[model samples]
Target: MAHATSIQYEPVAEIGGGAYGTVYKARDTESGQFVALKSVRVQTDQNGLPISTVREVALLKRMEQFDHPNVVRLMDVCATTRSDQETKVTLVFEHVDQDLKTYLEKTPSPGLSPERIKDLMRQLLCGLAFLHSNRVMHRDLKPENILVTSQGQVKLADFGLAKIHSCHMALTPVVVTLWYRPPEVLLQSSYATPVDIWSTGCIFAEMFRRKPLFCGESEVDQLGKIFEVIGLPPEEEWPTDVTLSRTNFPPLMPRPIADFVPEINEQGAQLLMKMLTFDPLKRISALNALEHSYFQDEETLTQKKS
Candidate 1:
């Protein structure tokens, strides 16, 4: 709610940039706290501000009311007039030390410990459960969208691709990044929260393997990679009315989870299996995932600590 001119902050460094805008790490003068300032390039049409920006701002505002720990908090929203008469919208967010991608890259050869991995996954699923309960679907949920703090806390970030889900409506299947996309979305079928679950599963695997589980080169190739590992879903498994682009997919045999990611324990593998199920209806919900046996030990430990 504060005006851009009212805040005094010195840019420390450019953290990241993309098609949307550049993010900078800045020190807030008033609060004396480090924050991330994401400067969005405003592309106004007859309708005024870009819909993506509008949606993101609105969603973040809504999320602020709940103050979920695993969800990134929007500190402020401000705008500045450019020399060219255009306005740049800067979204101030709580600063995070690094993204999951960078953290994984810096992780040692064997990757994070099982306990740490469980904690991260728990936080991710907790955040997702909160989002889904609020009827919001984070369409893009890759490692890059997951933020990590120095103290090992995980927060979900980047809501630009997110949208409020209505049960009666049919959303576009073009959501989510390629590797993390689910089969329903790839087939242009009507989808909902399960799409996010699929992405979460991808992130879950990456946490242990330090690489994407399904690294498909193209959409077709991506589907091939998925089938290569999980095998083609039988016709009975397909949604009754949904039709896929290719009915004659190669009958690749499904490999055991151990073959792809042996580092994870059997319980972790079981959770991954449910998350990666071909049928969206069969995929594990975030709330249910939190109750999975894989997290039982961690839950017990947390309880003991408390």
Candidate 2:
């Protein structure tokens, strides 16, 4: 395989695009390896790279130090010039079969099995553990950020909102997509890695059912959906820094996990409850979560593979 230092790749096709960049499926000319290249436009206004793009580049550079099957691999990064006078910075990542959202939409099978969901949850937890161990918070952890490889392996990707713990001092809660965003974040609490865990729980539910567990239209509505499932957090459970701490949120008791998603097994429900705990300190960390009973079989599979 050609290292990042080598310039050898052939464009395959455009996979997706967003405001900051366009993702292209490409093949390494030297090794014939397929990879996804995210090309971000170079913006300069007498300053360096855009703050968002720079943050992503820096995070990817740091993540490169560690390698895990469940974490997307950064193959390379290089600058390319376009005839239109735009210099684009391209991020090279290992090719994934498709994003989880797309894969779920295309899967012909019925809903995912309990075992398959467990396997994916374990992989996601492993990837989250890697990120949290390095003191990085993947703020935007949703189904779209979860990619499925051609071999059916699940990898965590899309770190545009990710933040290194010390880079910005304490974490700012101004991140995460609304659907998967933790309630603490919505309430503007001082967030930590637990926020990512909360989002992971939401993704786990979505993967199993092929629909968002809490599909709220607005922030208020979103909180309502969460409260509907997990029950209202007691006043004592609210963090000191959480916004509207003094404001009275209704006292809606949490419903049984089985009531909403009966398809989820008891173990899965337990894991989700741990992740969605109102108290961040009480919430299960990814490191501890990897040892949960839901992943006992996954541990065996991992050992067999090793």
Candidate 3:
């Protein structure tokens, strides 16, 4: 890997930061193009590169190889020696104008137009389908991780929590963000690609409602919130052999998607319900979702405009 000092780029501004490191908007000195630089703090001790960092870098590199437009492109990865002489890994990526969270905050009361929502959702599902087909689970699919360019193109970002899924391997249930976490994950049941679909459903609903569908303070509370909307699924709905955390949830009536998100049309509601299905096996896949009537209308509208 090249050292950050060898790279020709000037930091423009600090964009965001978390426990891992800070992200900045920078200009590539050679190409005169703007890019996002994410700096990850590394442990120089015997531990070496963090597993999270390793997984993220590997996944991003694989995505780069495929050059999927819906997924954020990882431009480069370089190591930088800080003033303390400790090495930090920096990831270079195509800069997006804003995240979906900020975009929604800036939109007016009624939220985005139906067409715009459909456009963004289509892009999200396309990216997710690409990831799922490759056997990768985003694990953390939230509004903050979905980037939007000035041209209205949506790209999936933040692979830090992502992992390659295999039937033989058991994954941690404590993966996705609280608001967007699926019922299976909360219930500590073995999950797979459908978890991403569940998060996508939460994000899809948030696009129309401008708020999270299930805002829970704790795991139990989150399950309660989900049950409040969709009702508790009977034991028969889940795999008979596997054990679940909250099997005794109060019997609640499932509310109609239209009643929950009145802004979305009937077709949109139908798709959302399928994505948010209690059973992961029954949840709609990203590719199947892309084929839904909701996006078909968007396709017709786009063709008309052109």
Candidate 4:
């Protein structure tokens, strides 16, 4: 049944009716602070919470203890059982009014400065690296879920929640875009943390172009779109387990990253290529990506400014 802590949050409005389950803006009566309440209804079925949901929640809670600057704060968690078969798991997160999607849309016609993009990518990678090091794969990463604070802090939200969302939705109605997905995932190959790095690379290019790099309509279409830029991998590079043949894509050579992300410099393009590499094994890890030469300019400029 519904309980006391649930009342502690006075609902202000429904923020999301889609992807992240039911999310609400609520006022914490005690602290007089605003927070986002994301509720997921999980099938209990005699066991308290499904093992998957329990594992995800544990991972989120563990990550919370680190108090990462670039990861959203998970403030509170409450479970209110509605029936023997169902339980509502409400997760309270510190609210941020803007997401990267909104931030990109609001950018002036000239678009974000290279320095601003660098700063955002740096923060994004830091958070991602933290999660990767902790053995957590974000599975889903895109502009909508990457929250941006008023002060321009980039906090990675919606990590470790895809499992919970899927548990509730069966198959979420939200049209999950293949735009940010890595090549392996599109091919139905096994994926790990590198999946997120590929998504970050897509987001990186999007920062420059102010629109998604690859907008594929389906898995095959998305792979074709990706290969159009990265080019089809060699026969040996293709995963043996996937049914999709490398011949499904053309024999075109890799295009210049600059062709798509024109504003990116030589260093940025090189790093982006490493990120978008076809082989998951060859993909750049978030920690290694942070050390890429592309970010050095920003570091040098920071040193000069200080």
Candidate 5:
């Protein structure tokens, strides 16, 4: 911010277009390090940058001070004026070579080892807990949004992007996958931090299966797929405010988690079930998730250093 972005950073290549705008892989001319450039076009008023943008960026900066190993680093932020009405706000972030989605794909044969998966999950929950404790909710938690360093370190990305993308959400053509969505979100009920836990559960199972646990085409279908495994929530547990009635879903009995993820051990299955609980209020918190028996193995300490 002390200097113009152009003078310090050089665009290396076009990475991909995201919800708000195109992201580029850039090199810090001074540090010779790679960074991702995520920019959003904002409507400008007499007040300059939108209040929401300022607040989110400030939060990101504050988070950087913690130097949390699990969270991605926000390298820098700069604003460029495009016209009288529009301004471009670009966020620079440390570039990780791959994401969990691809990492799972590249696993040599069957899939990740149990110890390896536990290590990844521990790093992931540590990051999530850090963000949650700081009051940042990762409304969208999926493989692609989670970056994995070459050394196998996990760093959460795009944690609060939804809020900053609120104004342009409708205009964006990208449709977020509903596979990781929980019943509460699928039913269009109110949600909170517990939403991320559900996604984490899905990812946890995927680590063993090397594929998605519940592949759904629509919100209704997604709920049905989820119910097929976790079973339909009892009438009293269903959110009263949601238009999607509990009766719409078949009254199914809960299936064993082992049925879906046979590779997971018994303790991992229990923790996964806790995270995928139907009620957000009862769903396990990220901090508690870290302490689950599944992650209590002493091997985790050795792997954590790996």
Candidate 6:
């Protein structure tokens, strides 16, 4: 922790690590603000840095304009200059209280009550709506990427795999981790914003149950878990020419959601099922989900029942 010509980075304890970078909680003296500095480890083949990191940095830089309550803020980008080696670029972001994984782990089972679940889901939907409105697809949406602030607000992070619907790149099925991946992605179809809705559904179930709704080890297993809770994918649900790498089409009837989590209410089950729909076209959009009875307030519920 040293202060130099207007730019001082105070390195705090390590927050987390990723494939190419190690994230540390830090303070930027220039702005007198706390930020998460993700330092990309420099490798040698006589090459500078990975192209993927460059892409992430560039995208995140542009995405800074997306200042929303539910979206993680990228503060600044700086370089670390050492004694005698190649310099490294560090991406700075807003410091979050904790990731949803650690948050869930620390909390007791039946941790988040129904009201809290609705609040979290509402915040998630708000974030997703903002991202979709900006045409940004968060390919990876899971507990690990959803962070909770000390103020109890949830914000979406980890834009390394995010794809901004811009003129710069082509849309490919660059699917994220198997767990949060949508059914359309599992079927090898070029995915869109609906994929995030699918992940949000999974996260919503997870927050309510305090565990992964679908803890599948592989793609087939993942699809199996999804099907188990939400039912199988009909052949007509998929596009004719779409290709699947692992699982076969004409899926068998899946097990019931009640069998897995009997405590979930009928409204919750219906909402989850719609989000997990095999057909992207049929999947619930985040905006529409926010309007659903699933997120209804006490007043709204009374009105609906009456």
Model 2 lDDT per residue over 180-246, tens place? 8888887877888898999998888887778888888777778888988888887788778645643
Candidate 6 residue spans exceeding 4 A from truth: 1-7, 30-32, 39-63, 79-89, 160-176, 245-251, 301-306
Query: Can you tell me which runs of candidate 1 are displaced by over 4 Å?
Result: 1-7, 41-56, 79-88, 160-177, 239-244, 298-306
Q: Give me the runs in candidate 3 sitting further than 4 Å from their true place.
A: 1-7, 41-56, 80-87, 160-177, 238-244, 298-306
Ranking by lDDT: 5, 4, 1, 3, 2, 6
By the lDDT metric, which is better: model 4 or model 6? Answer: 4
TM-score: model 2 vs. ground truth? 0.80
Candidate 4: 10-residue stretch with minimal lDDT? 165-174
**lDDT for model 3, on a 0 to 1 scale?**
0.80
Clashing pairs in 2: 231-254
User: lDDT per model, in order?
Assistant: 0.80, 0.76, 0.80, 0.90, 0.90, 0.72
lDDT of 4 at 190: 92
Give the least accurate 10-residue stretch of model 2, judged by summed lDDT: 163-172
RMSD of each: 4.7, 5.4, 4.7, 1.7, 2.7, 5.4
- TM-score each candidate: 0.83, 0.80, 0.83, 0.95, 0.94, 0.79
Q: How do all the candidates rank in terms of TM-score, highest first?
A: 4, 5, 1, 3, 2, 6
Which structure among the candidates has the greatest TM-score? 4
Candidate 5, residues 86-119: lDDT per residue as tens digits? Answer: 8888899999989999999988997899989989
Q: What C-alpha lDDT, on a 0 to 100 scale, does residue 87 get in candidate 4?
A: 83
Across residues 232-303, which tens digit of lDDT does each residue of candidate 6 receive?
Answer: 666566567665633553356766766765667787888888887878888989899888876665558679
TM-score, cand. 1: 0.83
Residue 170 in candidate 2, Cα distance off native in Å: 18
Kindly provide the TM-score of model 4 when superposed on the true structure, using C-alpha atoms: 0.95
lDDT of 3 by residue, 149-252 (tens): 88888899875433322211243233335899998887677889999999999999999889888899988899899999998787678555445444557888
